[model samples]
Target chain A: MTEALLHVDAIETFYGPIQAIRGVSLEVAPHQIVTVLGANGAGKTTVLRTVSGILDPEAGKVVFEGKDIAHMAPDQVMRMGICHVPEGREVFPFLTVRENLMMGSYTRRDSDGIAKDLALCFRYFPRLEERQHQRAGLLSGGEQQMLAISRALMGKPKLLLLDEPSLGLSPILVQQIFEIIRRINQEQGVAILLVEQNAHIALKTADYGYVLEVGRIVAEDHCATLLGRDDIKEFYLGQKEAGVRGQRRWKKRRLWN
Target chain B: MEDAARLLQLVVNGAAAGCIYGLIALGFVLIYKATEMVNFAQGDIMMLGGFVAYSAIAHWGVNYWVGGLIAIAATAAFGYALDAIVLRRVIGQPQFAVVMLTLGLGFIFRAAAGITWGYDSVGFDTPFTNKTVKLGGLILGDDNLSIIAGTVLLCGVLYLFFAKTRLGVAMQASSQNQLAAYYMGIPVRNVFSMIWAISAGVAAVAGILLSPVSMIDVNMGFLGIKAFAAAVIGGFGSIPGSVIGGVFVGIVEQLAGYYLPAGFQEVTSNIVLLGMLFIRPQGLFAERMGKRV
Candidate 1:
């Protein structure tokens, strides 16, 4: 593997007595869009949390840009160019949209560069420019997602780990959000590690995909290959099951015995 | 004419007292903004400030002005140490736990002061001139006038600090969202420690200033309760609000004592407090940034 931009090795995480992710290993290659597809409670969000240092791994290592950052603080991780847009888009509600954007560049001191980056954000979402002075809490779900993405962009991250970007979005907005993700990956050359529940769309957009079931990677393959596979199609890709395919899906095969 | 002059004197005296209460309330606000914990020990911390100055001036023979500065520094150091050793351990704890811990701390400080200074009340000599100024047949003590002027100066300085300085903005941001502030690379833990230090320092100044008016005693810490009332009258997090609240409480209390029946004065002060709360639950000048979530 050509030195991945972000690498995780056999990481385990827990919430008190309950083990969340057990020996989860994953990687995202430089400038590649990698998707981790899993059901709810499959530890998808936990993986991002561990890498971003919101949740520390009980075991294993997280390597970012050739540095071991398994135990680094969240801000320190961000400083090292890894921005996590957490699930639910936890925007500072009382702050103005402009103030929320300003907070994203809190670590930066270059006034000219910050101003330029802000202009760039407004260009990406003209809606943000119009609602710049309005409080962030008043924005619609789609607009908030745009602000979240733009806020992360202000951090100038080398890799963006997004959790459930399409969770509460409408279908049209979901498609638009995925398209924006693709454009960000292409135009900004920033690698993305996306964890999503919208399987069909995620599979379509991702360059490579990991099928995680119960905190373990059940399969890893090129997105096209995964999408075409008979077993994966029935299990995740929403293809019709059984009669025509006779695919030996693991869950079905196990049930027959 | 004599009665009118006396009324003017009482107003001036209450204003001076109100300024000190405002300064103390400022300390309360500073700590509350940073930690979201009410430091019940603020009064004891102020009492400790007075004792520190007393020891410096009496034993070390330091100039009174220099001794006052030393007291502030000593109290700040003590506050920092308290944060590092005691408060830091219980951070992110439940609100009740934090409140009880600080209350216990306040008691410990009071006990320590009792052990060291004994039960006797002692007078504090200040550097400010004690001349009485004549105005419209009323005499205002130079000390009282100085207290008012000093309070205005301190508020102005703090206003500039909060509005203009980078550190002040960072501190304000930290108060707004600590997790976000940490993620933004602000040293939040350090900010917490600094806030406590500054609070203790402010409390010490109030203690020293008040000592020349009312003799230093263990009972002085109870003034924190009145200061708490002041803070509530003004918005809790607002600097200007606290000052105005303190002065309003002080003047109202004085006016009630003079104009109302003997038993009614105490009841009237509380009545004013309740009236303010019933009308504006968030206080008259709180920032309108409250959120449902």
Candidate 2:
């Protein structure tokens, strides 16, 4: 994979007393769009949190650009060019849209670069430009999601860890978000590690995929190959074999139909 | 005409005193907003500011203006250190634990002040001391006027800083969502320490402005109780609300003292505080949702 950009080696993360992600080793090549597909309670969010330094792994290492960053603080991880857009899009509700975007670039000292990146964000989401002065709390759910991604983009991150961008989004919006994600990876070369339950679009947009089941990687392959797997269809795609059609497996996940 | 002048005089006097409460309340609000920790020692910090100014101006023969500025800076440094070394350790603990810790810190500050600055009440010479200005038919003490003026200036700067500046907005962001601010590459822990410094500086300004009207002593920090009431009435979250609440408390106390019998003046703030709790616990300018104290 032309040398990995972020290599997560057999990490274990504990959320309080409960061990969330265990022995989960995965690698993302530079500028590659990687997707981790999992059902509810499979530790998808935990995996991203561990890599982003929100939850430090009890065991194993997260090597970013060949530097060991395990157990570092979230701010330090961010300063090293790993930005995490956490679950629930925790944007500053009181600040104006433009102010929220400015916050994303808080580490940067160059005014010109910040200004250019700001313009770039607005171009990506014209809706944000129209309401730059409006309070972010007042934005619709979809608009807030757009703002969330745009805010992360403002950091000019080398690696972006996005947790379920499609959660609570419309089908059209999901498609649009993935399309933009694809464009961002290609144009900006910001390698993305996205965790999603929406298997269809995730398989379509990502270059590589990992199937996580209960704190473990069950499958790892190219997106196209993962798409062609029968097990992937049954469990994630919500489709069964011809004779077993309409009779779903009890373990089948709730997919975006 | 005499009655009108007396009422205006009472209002100005009340407002001046209330500005002190507001300033102290401001310290609480700043720290609370940024860190969700209510510093009960905020009043003691104000006391320290005044005592530092006293030493700088009277003992060392520094200019009053320069001494006051130095006191503010020195107190700010103390506040920063207090957070970096002490309060920073208490993050993520229960609110009750923080409340108790800060309350304990207040007693320690008092004892420390007693040892450092002595038990006796001290006063400093300000440019406005003993001066009076006649505006039309009314006479106003420069001490009272200076307090009002200083508050206006400080509040203006704070308002502009939080509204217009990048670091100020970043401060707002840090308080609203710490994890998000960290993701933005802001050093949230450091930002918190900086907020502590600013809060301490604001408390120091209150101490300096209050020198002529009141004496600076180890017990001067008890005024923080009144300021706490002021913060509650201002919704505990809003900046301007706390100041206005202080002014309101001050003006009401003055009116009660003038109209009612003697000894009623002392209980007036407590009564107002209790009444506000009963009538509007959320405060006058409360946000839609309040974080539980």
Candidate 3:
């Protein structure tokens, strides 16, 4: 494809003695929304951590913007325009929401451009503007998620790595979040590599998808094809109405006929 | 009227002494805020700073101010070197080990100073000799007045440094959340190193300032115990609190020494320190973070 913004080639990461990610290879093209769909403990978070340079990989390469940033420190990687919105939304609890957003642009020197982006963030999430002076820790769960995204946007990254943005949100809020993600993708021209356990929603939003199971990509295809596949239906998209796995498989085949 | 004048004199002396305590407390707060390590060796470091200035003035034939500047720079470099060599290795390990290591460092620094300067205390002469100002039939020494003025100037400069600069904000961010700061591209290690140097530099300034009032000795390192009390009084992380706490501690001690029995005077300050710990706990100005609702 059209010059991958982030290229991950067979990267393995270890936490002390335990190998969390084993030769995981992935890629996100410029301005594309790519989702890594997996269950919990499938090494999705580890992959993001490795690519973002929080944890160094034992082997393989992470090329961002054609630079080999495989073993670079997190700060150096962030300087190269890869912003990772980590799991649990680790927003600074003591800092004001405005201060948290300001911290996101810590590496940047363009004051005027940063101010403009901040205004754009307030436009994107008006709720943030209302609570601009409030401590980030006090924001509601959904609002905190919005603030995290807005803070990441403040970094003005070429690539955004999000780990389970829908983790603790209600269905309604999840839908709202997905819509905001869609807007961010379409408007910002920023590439997104989303790692999520919510496969149904992830497939709907992503242009391309990779199905991860036990630290390996079991399948990779266009999101529409993945959504349409019989195997995916059996494993992830089993219909609630069918109430039985085998029956749904037979029903899906019969429906096509 | 004579008793009131004596009391006034004690208060002024106490304030001057409190400025020194405040400077010591400020050093503790700076390093503690940046790294969460107490730097128990701070008093020894201050003593070391004084010795550096003493050597510079005596051997190098430097002016007292120039010697003071050189001493601050040298001690700052020493602090940075200590961080790089000793402190960096023990970081992310058991905090007790780090604490004990710093305590050991203090002893080592004191022992080194003792070897170099000998066991005897030495005078650190001020640029201004003992002069007096009279006001309403009361007298104020130039040294005491300068001590107050100097303390205010240092505090003001530090306040502006932390408030107006980008590096200061980055240091603040690092202190708040080291991991988040690192992830955000802030060089947290550099910030820690800078903080250690700054703390040492502040200690050097205190040492140089106090050298005029009191003779410099290895025993002066014990004054860190009192400064630690000052840090507690000010609310450990608060800069202004450190200064106020130091002054408060100094004044209380002076008043107790004057009013109470002769034997109780020496440890009277620790009683106020104990009261502060039991009553307020967080000091006057520290922000308490409750559970996030």
Would you list the clashing residue pairs of candidate 2?
none
Task: For each candidate, give the TM-score of chain B.
Answer: 0.93, 0.97, 0.95
Candidate 3's residue-wise lDDT over A9-118, tens digit each? 99888889988787888889999999998778889999999988888999999999899999898899989998888787877777788888888898899999899999
Q: Model 1, residue A40: what's the lDDT?
A: 84
By lDDT, rank the candidates, best first: 2, 3, 1
Candidate 3 Cα outliers beyond 4 Å, as residue runs: A170-173, A230-238, A241-257, B290-293
Provide the TM-score of the second chain in candidate 1. 0.93
**Predictions in order: lDDT:** 0.83, 0.92, 0.86
Write candidate 1's Cα lDDT for A68-107 as tens digits: 9999988788899988787887676666788777777877
TM-score of each: 0.86, 0.97, 0.91
Considering the two chains of model 1, state its CAPRI-style docking category: acceptable
Residue-wise C-alpha lDDT for candidate 2, range B1-293, written one tens digit per residue: 99999999999999998999999999999999899899999999999999999999999999999999999999999999999999999999999999999999999999999999899998988899899999877899999999999999999999999999889999999999888898888888989999999999999999999999888999999989989999999989899999999998888888899989998878888899999999999998887743311
Weakest lDDT window of 10 consecutive positions for candidate 1 chain B: B177-186
For B1-293, candidate 1 gives per-residue lDDT tens digits of: 89988888888888888887788888889888778888888888999999989889877889988998999999999998999888988878998998898889889888888999887887656765467878879887877887888788878887888655656666776777676565555667777888889889988988888876788888798888778888888888887888888888777777878888898656554677789889987876797767323
Q: Rank the candidates by DockQ, best first.
A: 2, 3, 1
- Per-model DockQ against the true two-chain complex: 0.34, 0.68, 0.54
The Cα error of candidate 1 at residue A124, in Å, is: 2.4
Better of 1 and 3 by DockQ: 3
